[model samples]
Target: MPLNRTTHRPVSTNALGGLYVLGALLALGVVWFAEHWLKLAPCELCLWERRPWWVLLGIGIVTIVLPKRYARFGVFLGLLCLMTSIGLAVLHAGVEHKFWPSPAPECRAPAFHGGSFKDWMSAMPARPNKPCDSPDYLFGLPVSMTELGGLYAAAVFVVALVGSFRMGRSRR
Candidate 1:
């Protein structure tokens, strides 16, 4: 059997699964950093697309903490998150393409910058249009919403897949 670098246990499957969560988090961090630190304001749909990610991040942390016996369940959870993010990314891409206007009312219009208690209490800014649909291209392909969304989803799926292999080991 292979030797474990840390605990010296045979590198149990559950530990590997935990690492999967960790890796996925790191990947997400990069995306987060790019968005927040770089001041790249996401469109309403982009923010909405991130909802599953927020949820999955929570689940990923919990999955790491839970008993190893539930590792398979965690894998499934990851898969669900992966699928959700992918779909949203596609929707964002669609919005960028103008194939269909963003269903979000916010994206349909502008924000309200009134200077009054009543104005502040009034209807807020309708979501503004997406600033970027194809800001940059990678390998001759535009870094449009759909493409990036698909890539992020694929990464999450891979991590979950790797995690899955480790799940069965602990249930034994």
Candidate 2:
């Protein structure tokens, strides 16, 4: 029920911060569901793309806890983390679409020579190692997870930026 001093409109920085926290949780939840329930194996680049969201969640939590005077700092941190997530998503999508090669060494497939069955089994990892170029679609959609992530991040960034601007103007 906080009123914006400049616009005389009701606004709450905590609400905006909650958007970030919930959005990050939702994203992570979807990925987890896909991995565990759907049995989707994430490639190295895909895993890398998740790092920013984890950080963003912490930023959101801090933003919600901080005083109104310091909330802007937390918002800025969330923005930075979202931007980093978008960048990683773009990189991953590009690799999936063959726009560029993945920079992660783990993305490459291991060369296996002819060996005994026991040796082969021992050499293989317990979980399947997916290649970065292989795309994982959600619900049979044509869009790759990376592309979806990038779009989601961009959307969140736009909303957060606008909300922060509206709230910040009252402080000036």
Candidate 3:
């Protein structure tokens, strides 16, 4: 199913922006659930994988507080977030699969690793990469990190695309 802001409401003004927000919340909740409830012990790779969802969530928030006219732009932002999430997740999955390499330089990249000692300290758990991109949890059949990442990305995409219904109007 395509991501929509919220499909439950009447499909006219497409004010059902809740879906986008919910999508972002869901993504955040997944991370939280995995860490606290599921005890997934996110590796640096897992944290990296979540960045895009976080971005999408941010856009969702703006969509909520801003004008309805901004909903379409929010949708576009959501799409960007999803695509980025998908790309990152794919790369993360590759790292997990050893399709390329682990301990991605992002953990230490000049591009990403540029930060203070506290930032580095906070990021330490994620550093050096987790021992094989293994999911800390197994739902039914040995759940994969890649699967979760893709799931969030797909949700973000849906929210963003659906936001399109509210496009091109400035709040009157």
RMSD of each: 7.0, 4.6, 8.8
On a 0 to 1 TM-score scale, where does candidate 3 land against the true structure?
Answer: 0.66
Q: On residues 48-130, what C-alpha lDDT tens digit does candidate 1 reach at each position?
A: 76677666666667776777567457657767777878787777777677777677776654466758877865665544345
How do the residues 122-164 of candidate 3 rate in per-residue lDDT, one tens digit apiece?
7555435445456454676665756676866776566546545
How displaced is residue 67 in candidate 3, in Å?
Answer: 2.5
The per-prediction tally of clashing pairs is 4, 0, 4
Candidate 1: Cα lDDT at 114: 59
Local error of candidate 2 at residue 49 (angstroms): 1.2
Candidate 2 structure quality by residue, lDDT tens digits, 1-172: 9886754553467877898899899999989998999999989888898888898888888889999888888888888889999999988888888999999978876567998988878877677779999998888899998899999999999988888877877665
The number of the candidate with the highest lDDT is: 2
Q: Rank by lDDT, descending?
A: 2, 3, 1
| Error of model 3, residue 110, in angstroms | 16
Model 1 alpha-carbon drift over 4 Å, by segment: 1-20, 110-141, 162-172
Tell me the lDDT of model 3 at 29.
85
Could you tell me the lDDT of residue 69 within candidate 3? 56
Q: Which of candidates 1 and 2 reaches a greater lDDT?
A: 2
